[model samples]
Each structure stands twice: as structure tokens, then as C-alpha cells.
Target: MTALPGPVSPPPRLLMGPGPISAYPSVLRAMSSELVGQYDPFMTATMTETQELYRQVWGTANEATLLVDGTSRAGIEAALISLIRPGDRVLVPVFGRFGHLLAEIAERALGEVHTIEVPWGQVFPVSAIEEAVVRVKPHLLALVQGDTSTTMLQPLEDIGALCARHGVLFYSDATASLGGNPFEADAWGLDAATAGLQKCLSGPSGSAPVTLSERAVEVIGGRRRIEAGIREEGDEDAPDFIRSNYFDLGMILDYWGPRRLNHHTEATSMLYGARECARLMLIEGRDAVMARHRLHGEAMLAGVQGLGLVVFGDVAHKMTNVVAVEIPEGVDGDAARSAMLADFGIEIGTSFGPLHGRVWRIGTMGYNARKDAVLTTLACLEAVLRRHGASVPSGGGVDAALDVYAGAGA
Candidate 1:
């Protein structure tokens, strides 16, 4: 038999891309700690603490706050599939790629999906969404809080009230904006919200933190079913069982709750990483972390513009975590990106769909959302663009970013 490869080792990289940014050191350390049994006291305590910490992160008092043992999309699916029944109407407002993902998941969940679209770079106004909700009269409104593809942040302040007025359940995927942007689940009246440990949370992407309101919990609890192996004599099943047993939130909740029923074996290491991510965020204070993102995000924006680059989309509605800039003429976009990665060990992102090949996405988020990271990316980008014969003023990018930091008293 052929011998296996040696122990794993990854190349060093300064991840300045849109997501999967560098995780915080504490989170990594937490993940490397010893493992415990699923229902052990230490393991359960860690889980409970994680839920409470995420409650602060999500700005909710939800008792159902917990982690889904998968990526951010898994959390999105769990929330949608549990809340939606066959033939129940769901309204989705699409602004970018993730919106389409939500719609597709809803359709798979047997929801009568209705979608309203705006151009990729724009977000829907309160009036427009309300108009659709009133006309469609959907049972649920599934939307993305922040779409990294277009770097647009849909405002939820008014949409929540609109959903309540029309008796529609409100749900949002906050995977990209949860830690770095301002998101108040309780104040925004969100019935359900889901997020990931990656992006602004400054951790890896396996676990997803989810919060559900009392109304949403009631809806899901109505469809609860006990697993056959663990079912008691008094257990009763709903007529229409949740389509996917693995994605069922009802049974998952029982495992998280006092009953401590066994479902799938909890992903213990991921839970530790997720817990540490939330703990660090709560320690730093949510508003402060958001302010930090704003500071560095603005620096990156100003720096790119100083390099004679034009930014894409409506800047007024841009998220504080990522920015998309137009690729200049006479520059081979792919070649410049390759040079940046190969020469500088730095990684930036490329756009998708209509914006693909037209723009480059620069992210200031998570562990990389800092003045040094932004300045380094800007300096390297300027060098890369200059090498490609693009007209970039010498020292312009770094100077402009420094000015922003100076103005912010950083």
C-alpha cells in the first residue's frame, strides 16, 4: 500500500477576501481544546453559554437561540423548512445571489415561493416590499440581511413592521453582517435570524448560530416529531412530518433544551469555536465592533478610490464589511489577482454574475478588519495595478486611508 501524506500544514495567507477571513486566535485555541461526551456537564454548559452569548450577539431574548451543526446555509434551511409547510406562500425580495438561494431553498421546502427582483446592486425600499407583501399575502417573508455579492445591506427596520402589519412571519439570513454590522433581532422584530462563525464573527464556518422568536418557535413546535428510537408511549407525531429529519428544528430544540434528547452527535469542536467567537464579540461590545468595521471599511473605500478606481453599486446602502470596485481598463483582472496572491501572499475576491470580470471585491471584516490589513491590501493593490500599467498615483492609496484613520482618531 502507498504511504499516506504527512501531517497537514497550510500555507500562510493574509485573507482580505469577502469571507472566510482569518479566525481569531482565541477561537482557534478553543477549538483545539479537549473533547467531551455529548451530554457531559462541561459540554452542555458550553452549549448553554454559547446560546446566551449569541443572544447578546443577535440582540434577542429568544430562548431558542442555538447552533446548527453546519454552515450558514444549513441554518437558513433549518429555519425555512421548519417554519414553512406545503403550499404555504413565501415572499422573497431578491437583490443578489443569496436572495436567489433563499428562494430556491424555500421552493424545495414545498413553499409557494414568490420573488420580486431589483437590479443586483440595489435594495428594495420599504414601500416596495410592503406593496408586494400586501399583494402576495405570503405566510412568510424570507430575505437576506446582507448580500456580500453586491455588498448591499437591506434595511430591516421598516420591513419588520411591514411584516407584522400584514401578519407575515419575518426571517433573515444575517450570515455576513451579524458581528460587524448593526443587527437588532428584538428591536427589528425578526421572527427568525441565522448567522455563521465565519465573516464578522472571526471564526471558521462550520457552525451556525440561530435565533427564533416565540411565534416562530410555536410554528415549528406544532410540527414536532419524536425520533422513533427515543419515542415515549405518549409521544405524538404531526400529520405532515418535517420533510427532512436532519434539518428538523423541533427535535433539535429538544436536544438543546432540558430534556437533552439525543439527535445527531453534536459537533463538539465546532461548538467550542462558535462559543469563543461569540464570547470575544460580547467582550468587545457589539457597538464597538461595528464601529471598528465602519472605520476600516471606510478606509478601504477611500483608499481604493484614491487609487483612481471606481466603486460599484449605491454606496449609500453598502454594508460595512465589504466593498466592490470596478476593474480598470487595460488591466488583466485575473492576472493582477493572481500576481497579488502569488507575489504578496494576499487574497482578494472576485465578483459574481453580472459583476463578474468587471469588478473586484475587497472585504474589511473579522480578524482582518483593521487599519493595518486595509492599508496593506491597498498598498499591495496599488503596486499590482501599477505593474499592470494602470495609472495609480504614488502613495495615494495609503495616504487616503491614513487620513480616514486620522479623522476617526485611530
Candidate 2:
């Protein structure tokens, strides 16, 4: 056996990249609190409080709001697998990489997946999605609210109404956009929505918060199957059992609901972090947190432009948390990113798929969405660009960002 090094002490990094962004200190502290039994009064009370807090964050009255025990994709899979039966037609509008991921997960669930596409850096219009829905006549419309890969925020306001008009169940993956952008689950008529704590919620990427409307709950509940070990006498399983037991939302609902059926032991520390994330967002006011993201995100955007770098995608429809910029001519994108990390102790991200190697994605989100973080990143980026023989105006980046902050009265 190879002997490993002693106790772990990692290098400190200012994570200014797409995600997972730096988590709030309060969230970290919450995770270190004392543990309790799953059904202990304190534990159950904390769970209930977390649900209520997320209700405010999602802007919904969904009684089914709770956290999934894994990463953001776990929530996505749970929602999709439980909602989509075999041979059901699911329509996905692909604008970015995550859209493709949604379609793939649906296919694995035995849903007949149909997809409509736009370019990587653009989003689908309501009319385009409506046109596809009319043609495909799908049972569910699975879409992404914000895809960090493209830095585009698909406008969901009218899409839900259009789906309702056509009898299509609406679901969205809001993992990258939730707290940093405006999302109204009930008002928007979303049957199901899922998000994670890593992005704008300022926590580690372990737990996924999910909310389901009454209709969505009804569909999933119809497939409920009590685990054999926990099944009581006379309990019956559905004819079409959910293929993946861990991702079964029906059984998960029973566990989270008043019945408190045992499915798996709740991840207690992650639950604490998730609860703290929602609590901090609610304490600050959801709109206020989103406005902060916008303020800092705009600063980062203006700063990059001042450095003579072109921004990617349609600016008007971009999310308020992250921005992608074209890699400068005569500069090695990877080398510059490496220097930014190795020398400056800061981190930024490179894009994927079509945008890969051509663009760098920087984020102003979560606890790092602040004037200092934005300005510091721009300052380091300017140094890296200049060292790489790219011509950049002296103090231009910081100046432009300051101008934005000044305009915002920050």
C-alpha cells in the first residue's frame, strides 16, 4: 500500500470561476455543528425549517420542497426518472451542454426523447419551443433555466403558459441560476424545478433542492413503491416500478413527508449546509441577493471588456452570475488560466464543447459576488494578459468596473 501524506491542508484559492464558487462562511460553520439521529426532534425540526426556507427561495408554495442526497444531477435524475414513464414523449430544447445532459438522462429513463436545437451561445425563444411542442406533442417539456456553458438565461416566463395551453408538463433545471436570478416556480407554472447550493446559494455542491407542484407530485406518487425491508403488511408496489431506487422521487417524497418512511439515511452535514444556504439567502432577501450578483457580474463583464476582450453569447439574455469572454489573440488560454491560479492563487474556468479553448468563463456569484473579488480577478487577469504579450490598457479593467459600481451607488 502506498502511504499517503499526513493531515490534509489545502492551498487557499479565490474561486472566481463558473462554479462551485466560494461558499459562505456561515454555511461552512453550519456543516460543523453537532450531528443528530435522522428522526431526532432537532433533526426533523431542522429539516422542516430548511423546507420552509427553500419555499421562500423558490418563490413557491410546494409542499414537496426538499433536498436530494447527492449533487445537482441527482435532483435532475430524480425528477426526470419519476415523472417520465417508459415510452413517454419528452421534448428537450438544447441550447447548451446541460440541455444535452437533460436529454440523455431522459433517454436512460426509457422516455422517448425529442430535441430541438439552437446554437451553443444562444437560447430558445418561446415561439420556437412552442412550435416544437406542437409538432412533437410531448408529455413533458424538459428545459434548462440557465446553462453556464453558454452563459445564457432562457426566458421561461411565457414558455410555461404556452406549455399549459398545450397540456405539456413543464420542468426546468435551475442548478446554475436559482438564487442569482429571478425564478418563480408557482407563478411560472413549473410542474417541477431543481437546483443546487454550489452556484448562487454559496454552499458546497452536495445537496440539491427540489420543488414539485401538486400535479407533478400526483404523477410521481402514483409510482410509489415501499422498499421491501420497510414495507408493511398489505402495502402494494406500483406495476411500473421506478427503475432506479435511489432516484425514485415517490419513495423520496414518502421519506420527506409526514410519514417519514425510511429510504436512506439523510446526509446530515449536507443538510445543515443546505439549510444554511437557504437561510442566508432568505435573511438577505432573495431579490437583494440576486441584485448583488447582477452588480458584481456586471462589474466583471465591464472589466473584461475594458481589457479589450470580447464577451461571448447574447449579452441581453445572459445570466446575472457568470460571463464568458473570448480568449485573446496571441495568448495561450490554458497557460494564462494556469498562471492565474498558480501565481495569483485565483481560479477561472474554460468552456466546454464548441466554446472550449476559445472562451474563458468567469463568475461573480455566491459569497464571492463582491466588488473586491471582481476587481481582484480583473487585476490578476490584466497582469496575466500583459505578461503573455497581449496589449491591455493600464488600469482600464479596474476603472471600468469601478465605474459600474459607482453607477450602481454601491
**How far does residue 223 in candidate 1 sit from its true spot (Å)?**
2.2
Residue 118, candidate 1: C-alpha displacement in angstroms:
0.7
The TM-score measured for candidate 1 stands at 0.96
In model 1, the Cα lDDT at residue 162 comes to 86
Query: What lDDT would each prediction earn against the true structure?
Result: 0.91, 0.93
Candidate 2 has an lDDT of 0.93
Query: Candidate 1: which stretches are off by over 4 Å?
Result: 225-241
Clashes of 2: 0
Per residue, candidate 1 scores C-alpha lDDT tens digits across 1-410 of 99999999988888898898999999999999999999899999988998899999999999999999999999999999999977789999999999999999999998899999999889999999999998999999999999999999999988888899999999999999999999999999999999898899989989999999999998787655332333445544323537887889988998899898998899999999999999888888899999999999999999999998999999999999999999999899989999999999899989888988988998999999998899999999999999998999999999999999999899
Query: Where is model 2 poorest over a 10-residue stretch in terms of lDDT?
Result: 223-232
TM-score of 2: 0.96
